[model samples]
Target: MQTLSTDVAIIGAGTAGLAAYRAAREHTDKVLLIEGGPHGTTCARVGCMPSKLLIAAAEHAHHASHNGVFGVDYAAPKIDGKKVMQRVQKERDRFVGFVLKSVDSFPAQHKISGYATFVNQQQLQVEQADGTQLTINAHRIVIATGSSPFVPEFLKSAGDRLLINDDLFELTDLPQSVAVFGPGVIGLELGQALSRLGVKVVMFGASGSLGPLQDEKIRDYAHAQFNQEFYLDSAAKVEHISHQGNSVQVRYQHRDKGLISESFDYLLAATGRRANLTQLRIENADLTLDDLGVPVHDRYTGQCGQSPIFIAGDVSNAIPLLHEAADEGKIAGDNAGRSLKNAADVRAGLRRTPIGVVFTEPQIATVGLSLPQLKQRGEHCYAIGEVSFEDQGRSRVMHKNIGLLRVYGEQGTGLLLGAEMFGPAAEHIAHQLAWVIQMRMTVPQILDLPFYHPVIEEGVRTALRDLNHQLHIGPEMVEKCLDCGPGA
Candidate 1:
């Protein structure tokens, strides 16, 4: 057996895995990245990147279908699904190739096709694709294998038509009709996209809410606008098939409303995803797994207690979102490598705050403790303010005025704890809010910052004004402004 040793070993080369790999390499020379399967199956290569491309194409088609709204009239836009798929696949291929090339810079070794199983506490028996087994011993190991789409027990995985995010793109032809079993971000975005692509889409959710992080107002607006049929409060009992050449059947109940049946061209199990750690044999490394088989790690350090092992990305069971995975992986990689540099006193980075974004048109983004979450925690914070995109000149000029920005401030302290924004450029705005929360800036600090006109940033100025008004600081500031100038 070929034996190897490294300062840190990272399994999974996806977002978090790559981040960890890069960070570890920056700190030390001996870093190894081991990955299973073909590299294209990663989220960036397959899930998020490809899906977003298709979603963007669908969104463009949707906009073109409404040309009259923009003073241009047209018949419906024809969706050439094949053309869209071709472009998406091309993009996915280019991205994966680019990422692989970039990772070559780090002082790290890559094992493209290997199944790593723990042979002992500090050694992992690596089985290559061609049946060659090797052993790699590492002082610290990071599990960033990420996650796979979840298949609910109620939904049988027998048929080929049923798809997850990974398999959704493999279809030779577009599904005429689909039943998406979850109304979270994935299902909502894909359902809307498929609907625009001439696919009749229905979404099923246990609760009435669509996206857990989505504001009710925004979700309601989307559900009302889209042609998607939502089966809220409905639980699927068992989705099965009698035989081939037949539609997939779903048996569900509307809580107190009893039973019902529905059929569709395909069923998408967008319920959620769980970590792909089954192959790793976590027990062999003295690491613990949660009910879903995700690794248990300290939130601050990304370190698995009782084991010199850590995990980031989907394996950590944090938000499972892309950005969250990236940041956690950054910390995991840094900590793993830094541990060697300052083995006696190294402390990993802590995630005191998290930002979330759901990429829906009029997309929504949030950071820190939300109002309800704060309320639930008995946090008395009363600095509440909201700004309408309609009031912003930039949004008006861009014809993207359908949005709202809400800020929750600490009652006595002017520090911002939470911010939620929905509308055009919400993703960009969310990052700015994340900085605001991270710094815990006061309202005065925000108002003092100069922002240019005819830009979405002006929205932050408006939000600050509203916050000052809510705090009755605007009147006081205006009175002080006259005499508080440089001359005064």
Candidate 2:
């Protein structure tokens, strides 16, 4: 066994791990990055980049096929599944190659290609591929082991027929038909993409809401839009699933649709994700495991137990978006480095404005606190402002007017709290709202900002204006310039 020592040891080389490593490197040169799996981060290799590539191809086909509404005539768009997957893989490889290039820059000894297990609080035992062993002792450690797609045992029985986001993009060709087992972000995005790509997609979910939106209005709108695209049993309770030769069968009970039995060419499980901690041997550390079998850590600082270990990224199981993962990694890495000096002022707080999006057409996006979250926190006196894109000028012109945007604000104060939207340019709108919520800006303040006319953003302005009216703050208070004359 070889022995090594480092100032900081970072487990996992995915998004969160890479961010932690970079942040830790700023304070110490003696940092070791350990990867027990592939070098490419999840976003580059599978999660975001590759999935968006598939969505882009699907969007092209969808737009061409549905151009009649725009008075644009074209031949029926036929997609080649093999070529589509090839393009996605080619671009995905490029992204993965970029991450690998960064990994190659570190000293060969600084990176370990092995499975890491905790021997104790400060010591780790790593087993290499060729059966060699290495022991690493570090003053501080950051665990960013990421996560894995949680497929049900019944679904996994189908073997090669089971497709998770991890393997969805790796396919040589798209399956002729698919039964999507969940209608969360992964399920909805992939299911819609596949449907647009000319695959028969049937989606099943326990709730009518799409993703994690807490607003019933937006959820119902999303359900309607998505239901129009494919066969979705939103109120489904899946009882059994099994493999049938090359295909898979699903048995479910639907609220209004009654018992339904269906089979498809493949089964894609978007049930959810579980933290990758089976081999972490966290019991050797002083950290306390949560109900989900993940180490309990401070959300703001990522400190685990009373030790110098921190947990971040998908492993923390807070917010699973790539951007949030990076934020968590930075916090963990920064705190891990500062722990050497016992610095009390070195820790940073986690992001308060939560921004999440599903990249389906007429994208679904939410920012900051949702209606349910606010209600759960005992906030009940908020005002709601909403706009339907169905009548919005820009959406009407673009023929993309099939969703709604709702903003929540303090009833009397007009302070913007959160927003949920299902509309065109929802990604941009959600991002802007996130910034507004982060800055604690009110609806009137947001309205004071410039909004170009006849654009998707006008929808936001309309919502804010409606909120301003409901708040009934005097014009002088809302318009800060009201007290000023022409040349005050």
Candidate 3:
């Protein structure tokens, strides 16, 4: 057995782990980064970059086939599934290579290839692949183990035909038919993409929820828009799943059509992911655990009950987005590195305004506190401003007029709280709203900002204008206000 001591030891050499390493090294030279699996961010390897590559391909194919509405006629474009997957794989590997290069630049002594388990709050036992065991005693520890897809036991009936988002990216060719379970971000994006690329996709969800939208109005609107492209049952009643040779057979209750049986080339499980915590043997760490088995830590400081332990990234189970993970890692690493010198150093870090985006045609986006979050404070505490893209100038001109935008404001202060949007250029619009919310801007303040004429952003102004009226602080919205011009 080998024993080592370090100022800070970070588990999992992914996004948060890498960030933690850099942050901790700024305060102390004795820092170690440990990894059990390959060193690449979830975003680069499986989550964000690869998925976006696939989506990009799907978008091009869809636009090529649907340009007839623009007074331009084109024959249906042939989708070469092999070429699509090849490009996706090639680009995905390139992104992973960049991450690997970064990791390679780190000091060799600071990197350890092993699986770590907690021996105590400040001690870890690492088992290397070459049958070597090492005990690590650190002044502080950060858990950034990340997460994995959670497949229900029932889905195991499909045997080798079952697939997850991780497996989907490894495919060399798109399947002919796919039955996607879970209408969350992964499912909706992949399902829609495959359908657009000439694959028959049927998405099923247990909860009647779409990607990240808490507002029912926006959720329903986005749901309808997606259904127009592919068959999606957000609230599906699935009976059974079984393996049938090279295919998977599914029995489910179809809405308005009663019971139905179907077979697919693969059963794609887009079910939620669980934090990778169990293998660490956290029971020995004497940490307070939540119902989901995650440590109960301070979100601002990333400290676990005033101990030398810190948690970050997807393992924190707070915000699973990549940006949030990076922020949390920096906060946890900075605090962990400085905690031994001064307790005051373990202060709150910068937690940015929340923002989420789903890259589907007529994208989905949420900024700041959602409508449900505001309602939790009290229904009357906030007012809503809404705009339908059905008649928005730019959206109509581009034939992308198919979504809704709802902006929220505090009743008395008229402060912009959050927004949920499903529309053309929603991803860009969400960023603007997030920045405004972070700056604590008010509805009128946002309205005062310059908006370029005849743009999708004008729709945002429309919502803000409506919100201003609802707050009784501005003139009532005029029907086809001449100042706003036609389709404004």
Candidate 4:
């Protein structure tokens, strides 16, 4: 048995926990990061960083298969799934190794490979894999336990039939057909990845609008590109599964369309995710859970309203994006390091809204408030913008004219409140809008800023000009309407 103490103890070395470890070092001398799983599941490890590499590789194959429009026609290249999986592991290993080595700079007092059990407030019993027990005490704690994939109850006790994001790369061979549940980011990203790799994917989800967090235009545009059959009002209830020689048969009943049995090599349960907080012992930590058993905390600093205890990452009921988790964690780290919570409303300087990116081909990127959501909330907002991919010189050069650039604003101010771009470099535009929306920069202010021309960035300027027109109205609003009207 061993004992350790730190100024702040963080559990889970995922994105939030890792970022928090770095941020805590700014205010405190000692920060401890704990992980139950090995260091292979974080963003730098098996999450976005690695999964995206596989997705991109698969996309290259897709582009090769459909080279006719791009003027480079070619037959479908042989896809070596085993080789692709090998590269996936190889790349994930290299990147994750570098990240793990960087941890030495923070001097983690104990990076235990064990599940932490809270014996009491600020005290924990760490159970190592080798059956060794260690005691740890801390002045403050941040529960960054992250999230686990939510598998439906019926998928339980079934082996190899149902899979999650982590299990995809482990596949030995590609499935002939795949049935995907939920149109969330992970599911869509993975579904598209496999679909691009020539998997016949059928998506079943209750949401009429896919990627509900994104702009309506982007969502509609992507739905057009997916080329998959949508069981749109269908909530699948998996009744049973049977193995017939070599094929796996799935018996499911769609709520809207009655009973149906389908045979696929595999089924994926990507319905969503819930916090991995059960082993953390919430009662022992004296924490409260919402209906989902996720720790209830203030959206800002992630403080639970309990003294010296805060939460971060998916467990904190945040939006569960890596960047969102990292941002909230900086707040939690500051809260944990402080003796009296001296932080100035930790989310004060934080961006007022979130940015989301769906990593599908002709990818979707959106930041700030969506128009429908704004209308639902009855916000005094109106969006004026033009889709400008038609005029981009670079987009023309690439022959990748498949998406839109739309920006939204306050009713008449032309203040750029939100933006969504979904074409080449759409993710780059999303990153830019995150800052634009955060600072509440108006179109004029953004336009005045230096922007190089003959670039896709010009799309922003064009949208801004149209927004500016809507703002000023050219001092001829009634005159213009009157000329257009029958009375005129």
Ranking by lDDT: 3, 2, 1, 4
- Residues 287-359, candidate 2, lDDT per residue (tens digit)? 7888988998888888886787888899888899999899999989988887776746457656668999999
Cand. 3 Cα-lDDT: 0.92
* TM-score, predicted candidate 1 vs. hidden true structure: 0.85
Cα lDDT of model 3 by residue, 458-477, tens digit: 99999999999988889998
Q: Kindly give the stretch of ten consecutive residues in candidate 4 with the minimal lDDT sum.
A: 479-488
lDDT of 1 by residue, 364-399 (tens): 787877767777756454666777776566777656
All-Cα superposition RMSD per candidate:
4.9, 4.1, 0.9, 5.2
lDDT of each: 0.72, 0.84, 0.92, 0.71
**Lowest lDDT block of 10, candidate 3:** 62-71
Q: Higher-TM-score candidate among 2 and 3?
A: 3
The alpha-carbon deviation from the true structure for residue 22 of candidate 4, after best TM-score superposition, in angstroms, is 2.7
Best by lDDT: 3
Off by over 4 Å in 2: 253-258, 343-345, 349-352, 474-488
Which sections of candidate 4 miss by over 4 Å?
1-5, 104-108, 212-214, 228-246, 250-261, 340-353, 376-380, 388-397, 449-453, 471-488
Query: How far out, in Å, is residue 460 in model 2?
Result: 0.5
TM-score of each: 0.85, 0.94, 0.99, 0.85
